[model samples]
Target: MTDLDAIPDDPSALRAALLAMRAELAAERALRRGLEDRNERLQHFIRQLQRMQFGRRSEALDPDQLNLALEDLEQAVAEADAEAEKADPPRREARARERRQNRGTLPGHLPRIEVVIEPPTTICPCCSGAMHIIGEDRSERLDVIPMRWQVIVTRRPKYGCRACGSAVVQAPAPPRLIEGGLPTERLVAHVLVAKYADHAPLYRQAQMLARQGIALDRSTLASWVGTAAAELKPLWRLLRDDLLGSAKLFVDETPAPVLDPGRGRTKTSWFWAIARDDRPWGGADPPAVVFTYAPGRGHAHAATLLKDFRGILQTDAYAAYKAVAGAAGDEAAAGSADGGVLLAHCWAHCRRRFYEVAQKRPAPIAHEALRRIAALYEIEAEIRGRPACERRAVRQARTKPLLDAMRPWLEQCRAQLSKKSPLGEAIGYPLNQWEGLTLFLDDGRIEIDSNVIERSMRPIALNRKNALFAGHDLGAENWAVLASLIETCKWHAVNPEAWLADVLARLVSGWPNRRLAELTPWAWKAEQDALHRAAA
Candidate 1:
């Protein structure tokens, strides 16, 4: 029945009916607004996905942009839910209870401040008698304390001997990373970590310091960095020597631009990365990477960098690497074959060529190649972390047949296409490096790709994007030294800032050169873990 027909004749009854209708209408309007908001959000999310999939390369969103979009959508959803809860009070309570139940506990390492909230009285109102507590509720929330800066003042009092008044004695001054500088070793380490690890340039850091009422120039920070790099150069050299001594290594290089004041422009330099990670095959050696800055990307540079190395070098099909291996082979021909460096090609590089072709247009051959490579990757994933002998055996049993068939199929496909075509070139990459590509089948220690070192180069790229270019060649070398140590610390899951502070303090306090090995990231991590265990 209609509202009018169902209404009572009395004025009071009619007024009550009108109020109920108004409340119902308000709730309906709130529900409609919530639905509309949700619909708009869903539409935006769909459009983003479609654009990501079908958009032009130049129009596509980068990782950070995509993350930002998702964050906004999440916030919008939260707002809508909050409005809905405001409209329905009972639903608000239910949702709050559910959220409390699902909430994770805070970390135990953080200090807690207790706040006891007691009732006005402990007596029972009905009985007028004292009541004892039976239980209590407790909850925790994360909190943060803003960073504060303070100056450390040092003073030394000199005393004169009573008999020999001319002779005064006092304790000698402590050495620092920057002698007679305002900052301590810990503060200098923070600047280095912020610049290299966090990719905060010195100028930005100086600006941040200025906000905190400290007036420091970017050049002052740069000087601190240069002095730290000089002090830590010995450690970097030790790390490089240690990595090169590994029986298997992954190597890659990326362009690093340096400002050339004479030409009034930046010149392209290179940062060559050498990485050793044996954890994949369950080897005990800790993972580490070292970057060396070179003025040029030439065969001579690669040869000189690896002159003292004598092991397997896993890398992409870069021409300079081939020349280095060839020279090593020629030198070893007169002696032992084991002395030569062997090269293992990266299959990811080969797959990338095909992927690029498929991305541009439909190519059944390229898709088939990708599918086959993906299957090989799946098998590799299953055998990862297994012993070397077991991994080699599994590859021989399962991976060898696939590789055997893939090579012949690739040859047939290449024959069907023009040599200048994209598909033809993609197929030719693997066929050309068949020997090195199959090197992993015999030695499980060698990976299917040099992606390890490639992954290590990304931080350098991020730093380049932020700073644009280094001031000069020496600046680039310093960048390499600091970046190598910081990246190695990350691999070992150690705090780069803490480790750097301690190491810098030790170095300045006359840490013996012979004990430099103990200052390495892996060594420091081991020592820290040992201490924690002992404490436990």
Candidate 2:
């Protein structure tokens, strides 16, 4: 009415009016958006609280009603405490086992029998004619010696022929487990086991050794692990080749410490694992499992480890893996491996993020996803230890539908939810890993999660937690080999201590090429079993 545009030459008044109106509009919109996001997140948390409080219902949960129950809150807190306890170093479990082991000795070459001795006869000298034996007296018990470390000196004698001025030479000495290295095969194995299996840190290991009267230092022990790893590189390569050649593999990664020689700081090392099967593929020949160490979480390392990998590669949805997938596609297109890399997504990994956010917002989508996945796992449980064909059939008939149903639901939730929210993040991360997640669905050979490899990685994680960061790169890589061997033995149901001792004895005997494969956990296990049967 006042012809404001024509009067807008008054810049101060125009600007102030525009700013005030814009501020009011922004405030109103911001208030509405904030409430929507809060409600969304809260809704997710409530749903989680309900699921934790009540036995899970097949029907979806309502976020609004979830807050009405304090029982859910109490139950979830208990669960969180339980998880925290689990996250702790498994030292208590190890302590229990150690106590059990201490209570009973193995059937060693030495006998564990105890003999009772009657006390010497006692009577007055004057009444010696009626001497009588006294009650048995207490005797000192025998004490077992602690573990002692000593260097074995192996000398090769030279020979010469006196006749015709002819000279004779003896065969050369075989390489030591560590050339010019002071540690014994047993010591190396002990250090490896302590670090990986026992999760004992190097410094702690040094202390343990000291108690055994061995004056070893952590720095020195670290070197032993590195050198031993170098010696085992060939075995790691062989394992990697075998894993890639397999038709199915379950793979995962966890963080590792790598000392940067130049920077003097520990860099992040991801332990990448490729395993064929976890719960016994139950085939005549077991699938191979391999582990590799890389400094960066990049595709190049994966590309190298899987250079000839034409078979199914099961893994989680890490972006680095996608690059690997892209590279594998290129390789396949170029007829490199001659087969394509199939993707398998881990429903557990996908469910876990949602579960985490569900702590804040118990969203139905997360709980429902977990329920659906649980059903698939239940089917797997029902078909436990079944052959691939049988498992595939069961999964196809039952589990496939759950997967099919999950995809559309994920898509709808992704669309309906705010992109910025944690629910979106939780859903998107696994969805991104979708390529790997969906791999098992396409093929029966694939598994639900990359747990096979992840299980193998647990020992490493346990060891890392105890030992802390590795002292050096070589030490970390060495750990990878030892872990590969130990984990592989475990996977094949082989006793690690036995397999390790046997392999160490053989390898230190010059790593017999004709019998090197037998040094592998899987191979050595068979040999050990065969010998046991023969002796029996």
Candidate 3:
């Protein structure tokens, strides 16, 4: 029976029955809304899965490929337009005049080659007289020259004295990178740059050389790489020391695969990267990065890599890093000037968790968290490149209040969620690392994320992708050594090829070990700049 049928006839009883019916209706509406919300979330989750499985693999074409396709299309259109204009003389005249007027000049740095075109005869068509030059329209297009291989020959002559006959004199030959071997230091540098910086494997380089009829074996190229890496190890150590000496740095690691010949399979390794870029705060230190390869990713590995490093270490919320921070807490508590490392966690990581939740389902809490984090990053953008003191003051004045409100709000939201829920876990991440996440408010030198070191890992990733796996642990270590110097050169905007070429030559000439700092990318760039200014 309906509730109305069970109602009493008395006036007060009827009013109570109506109230009971209204309460039941409201409860039913709430339950229906909850079910609808859950259904909507499930729908979104399914759609996300479907998209992942069936969508285009990549969001966009590779930049280089896109540019090449555009170049071809532009050329084809130009050719077609030219043919059309040629079929009509008046259109040809109009188009030629417009094209010449609209043409852009190439860069001035490129060497210019001039070509002069003249009529069949140097006489005017109207009269049999010589034509004089008028204002000439000039246009420029870019060009390229293919790589050329050459050999250098050195000879030392000896002469015996006529009277003495025992005395002989000869000049000493210049130093060679490969003793009694064919390749020069410059060639070795090229191989290093191509393999490490350009991500071309030794076998591919050997094939390229073979195409040119050089016919060098892959093992020979590998030996040259190993030799160069041995010579460059000291520079890599110096770079590591230079970065560790800084008070603040970014540290991160990525997996590297090495072939396990005994098992005929691959084993996972790690490349630990430490980097510093103080340009954002107007600090004078030039940017640098050094990568160290380890057999495993463990707390012990991090401790060894950052053994003497003290001060702010920015990184993702990896437990290994947290372990390092915990170990250093003792010295920090003692108030030592060179205290243990203070962990400054990445906000990007925190935001990423929320982003994943929001993308998969209807998550107002995650979305709100992301919006608030974005506001903090916005303030960072405005204060970038300002003095550290000013940055600190601005963060304290502006960013602190937002973070202050966000902390309690996040806690309150998490209280309403089940701990096992995706949104709950997203909220828990930042809360777990609250201290490290908020540490940036006190120090201006620290970045909001460890993207500096993360950026340095991309080349390593590319090399791994191309080469598949390193032969063994030792080969992986060599990869670390060369990658360190090559990436540092790139950070300083120094041409890796040119810097490696010059430094390899100097090392072969027995450059002083104590003065290895002079050969670092930044120092070498400074010296080059000074010479250029003097010449100017």
Candidate 4:
């Protein structure tokens, strides 16, 4: 270290002093650079948080319904607090309190419990007269009893033939999902819904059961889930087959980690989501999604899963999908052969690449591209509910010209920007996948993006975030099976718990395989609604 006071005020003396402390100065500069880099990362993280909490969710810039709901709840809470303050004045608030007492009406369907409070004396205070009841103040309070366990005792008397003495008669036990297991169909369904739908892990669920004096081990719950998955797999298979049979399908994949016992860590697995939703294009087929778990994210797995298909496949620019397309041979590229799958890439994915670049830097080129793409979505919003033919004609007339103009603009920008840069990569994406990206121009039934299947992956993402990882590959497969049905039930706006309960009961009661289609979410919802109407 060189002291400034000891150094002379001459150029040569200062130069000599600087030379002596160059190593320390260099280290100080290096430390400053490191701190600056860390500061940049922390700032970037803060921007991400701001965007997530306040930024527009979709490319369309549609208003968030969740925010609207939150506003309504806040207004309700404010009003409640105001009411509570006004009610503090005992003399002036009696009438207002009386009006507010029964403001909320409980449903007539719920059973009521009554508690009568009589006067302390049957005489009036002013007069010494015995009085009959004139009026009564009745206040109803809703009550709930937590889940209680009960033992179901089935008494089946046995009788023998008295005269013949050769025959024996006994009532047989009813068919159950678990033949000898104590849980009923509803109980098994409850466990399934709790784990897959509610995102409750088995160990946590076991503790919850223990709180109710039902001391079941986590392994027991896991066994029940495995058995239920095996039983319910037929329905899942039927759903997948039905979805694949459709003419158009949206496909996407998300990572799922499976525990590796040998390595004492987790291995990366994949959950491939295949969906068929024609309502967006005015087709008559019901919307359905099916998820399949695989040991790896490879083209062979996708090819095998889609081997029986001859339809348009919508997906992102994953090389695996392209490999699958190539392996099917060049002839099947058009999807006209007996077994072919045509690729239709997602525009949302293309926009997302540039959106990230634009968020990070002020890229005018990316913004321009986004503006042009937004115009196409504006046209889509206008003609959404129209017939497929009408939609096709509109896209050809309006959207085609913008896309034609965008291609050359993208190419010209790519020539000027670095090929490895984010903007340049975004420009190159559409150029490489041009045919697939523009598939919507030719077909009216195909969507502009594979957003439907991506939307279906959110539940899996949330569940994985909560549970961290599945116990094993088989456990992940079971997760896929149960999650498929539960998510499908949500897609059809059916209560998952109710659907699972009804489906499990039906299976235990010997639901025929031929009528398996009737057990699907849409069909089951119709049946339940019909039965409710009949009962009403």
Candidate 5:
């Protein structure tokens, strides 16, 4: 009943003070709620990282998950473009760019095996007179002569020795890849190049051969392939050793399914493609790719394949690669303690993760990340063929600053996003492998991504897609061997068919192992060109 109690009961003046106190309390509550929400997001981020890094990948987003919505959007865009095109015709330049009908001049080196298609009647009907020799309009169409089956009769003339009447003189027949087989080395090479390089299934090739009245069974062709693979393995080993000796290399692997007879189903194998291409940064080594088939995708496989290699190995952020790098300390794999292989991770893979998430959920953070990474690619496109020193300077000047800004920016995004979200999961990849991801910044000789090796795997993919799977483990090994040589020929811009044909002939003709480099696609090309010039 004092003045204080009376003041508490008062309405107007106390109300203003109470209102101010209530406003302050509401703000504190709002801030606390915000802190709690942020903490929840952070916890999700941590859980996502832990799950990805340690927990089963099945728990995380499936790396191979497809976004159907993206396909739908693309189809919709195409339809819209088609409608627009119908309304307004395409520009001349665009039409010209699209037109691929222009036939170019064939190579001058090809022999002119002419078959003059004369007219049915050379006489003029009006005059009933035979037309004299006149200028003829010549049009060229590429003609392929069906494979001619020939019997190479090697007649070794026998004679009685003059000094000794009982002795007989005879010449020995040449050694062949297939001792009693009817196929010539060139024929075997043709079959191999068709199956491996051209992605033709053996059955299809057998059918084609049967049309020529050869009637060779599919098993016969398969046996030839197997024997050829065995014969060519020494060359494959040499190529692999040479590739490993390169200072910088790109590495990748694609699934190669092998038929498991015991299980009555196909088992997954791997064709590990190790590639060396120093041309990007202007290194002298010619680009090459060698494929090794393994029964499993175990870390030991990578270890064995790269055991002798002691340089930069650019690859994707596959966990097995991490183990491979770790095992550099082991004497068995390392060759020597000082000969440890350096790891360089692919940025394309990092961009790919963010790209997938961006497609599903459009956000400013992901869009920004994509835009910044695109800028790095733009810089790479510009300086691709430049010398290493110049490339290094440009990267340091242009790419380095963007990368420097990107690190903190990514961290800030991580702080804002929940790690469990797709964007957060995408962001965690580059963050975890940041050191490997940024290895290119230090060495210009190293590429940003293992795309060279990836490009080399496409033929294998095509071959597998057509052939389904190899019949057995040895079949997969043969696939690897032939694919490696044929793909390497393709890498050097050599006609794979021509190279295989020539190499096979030389191999059967006793090409020395010490002079194996002469039969290599690049060297053989130079030698062929030189011979052509000398003939000219």
Candidate 6:
């Protein structure tokens, strides 16, 4: 080989060298662009995901509730084929089974009923005589209670003063739950309680009430709700103050339909809830739950609810909440639109959306996230009904630090992922929604998510689905009243029907104003405790 041959290169060789360099650089640039896009997307997705999942609903429920949601979602997914999006034959069979047992208020335990006679013998317990069977035994199950109509009669008597030769009627009775109205206070209470606390609607209630021969026209029933609600306006305000005044408050909003009178359009109203238990902050009161009706579900609604409220405000990612709070500092506006509110985010909700997507695709990244979330839930489950302060300690010790470690891992997953993809939905959703999701860490009283509000919303949802819309402002307000009271009762573990019937039955004219409060669930509960103590 000549030295000239090694040194000299043909034009072809030089051209090939140039081409290789260009191709190598091009590949490197392309790889760099892919990494950058992945990082950007992951960042955005995480921020958005962090906003809120189911908000207050998931956090407020007991572990069993989460289990129930998991069960429902599992059954829902199993029966459903994403591509076909239809139930398989087996799924259809399961659907029938579910429907048969679809009563509401999902009983915590199956009741054991004792009968005097054995089932095989259709004999009467009183006579022990063989009796012809009227029909087959029938059973209907529901997610909660199935209401039936109950009539309560109140009679105020007239007494004549014969000795004085004067005729005087016993004072006209104090206003009933429905003063001179169609439905009894108990009936109105039942409707409000069912619709708001249980999420059953008035139309369904009309049907339910009809079963018991309480021929309530939906309009007439609506009128009674309006009237009864109007009477309780003062009470609602008092309750609202009680809730907002608490140091720890959880807030959430769900859409409610209000009838548009002139256009007949169903306007969306906001059903906002604020709940807090004094167990953490104040010792005396049980958990106080309050529901407020707003014209719209904007920041304004939330602002009004939390105005002048100094405490922890737990909410999800509606953007409106932060904006409204942010605007509170701008002094240029009319005397602060609303006072400052400290907001805490929810974790359970953010995790849930990811969990759903993870269900569809269990990639390594998603699986890891699932494992982390499961750990948090396990902590919450262990102390199911624990006090707020203890819960805070457990979460602070367990959840806060777990989330701190998870952040870097989440960022890494985001970098390797595509933004518009399913993985993006799972990963990015929580990341984007991070601020609110993390807000809870700072406040001991604020929940991990707004599950309590969501639980509160379910009762309203059931009622809305069945009844459809509130007829008028007064009608909606009445809904706020009864729902607020009954839900509070449910929150504190009191039966609303029992309280309302007893309160309404005792509305005597001469009774002192303070005595009337005994009808309220809190007061009624106090009275019950007193009675129980006496018996004990």
- Every candidate's CA RMSD: 28.1, 27.0, 32.1, 26.7, 32.8, 30.1
Q: How far is candidate 5 from the true structure (C-alpha RMSD, Å)?
A: 32.8
Model 2's TM-score against the true structure? 0.64
Which candidate gets the maximum lDDT versus the true structure?
A: 1
TM-score of model 4 (CA atoms): 0.70
| Alpha-carbon local distance difference test for all models | 0.78, 0.61, 0.75, 0.72, 0.71, 0.58
Q: Give the TM-score of candidate 3.
A: 0.72
Arrange candidates, best lDDT first: 1, 3, 4, 5, 2, 6
Candidate 2 per-residue C-alpha lDDT over 405-506 given as tens digits, one digit per residue, 9 for 90 to 100: 887888889999887788888778756665567656555566676666666677777766655565444345656777887777777788666566557657
Q: Relative to the unseen true structure, what is the C-alpha lDDT of residue 95 in candidate 1, on a scale of 0 to 100?
A: 67
Worst 10 residues of 6 by lDDT: 78-87
Stretches of model 4 off by over 4 angstroms after superposition: 1-151, 158-170, 329-339
- TM-scores, all models, native as reference: 0.72, 0.64, 0.72, 0.70, 0.70, 0.61
Q: lDDT for model 2, on a 0 to 1 scale?
A: 0.61
Q: Cα lDDT of model 5 overall? A: 0.71
lDDT of 5 by residue, 326-427 (tens): 777465464775567679998999999988888987688888999999999999999999888888888899999999999999999999989999999989
Per-candidate total of colliding backbone pairs: 0, 18, 0, 0, 1, 49
Question: Candidate 5: lDDT of 393?
Answer: 87
The residue pairs in collision within model 1 are none
Tens-place lDDT digits, model 6, residues 63-104: 332222222122222212211112134643454356345422
Once fitted onto the true fold, the runs of candidate 6 whose alpha carbons sit more than 4 angstroms away are 1-219, 261-264, 278-285, 328-340, 383-397, 433-435, 503-520
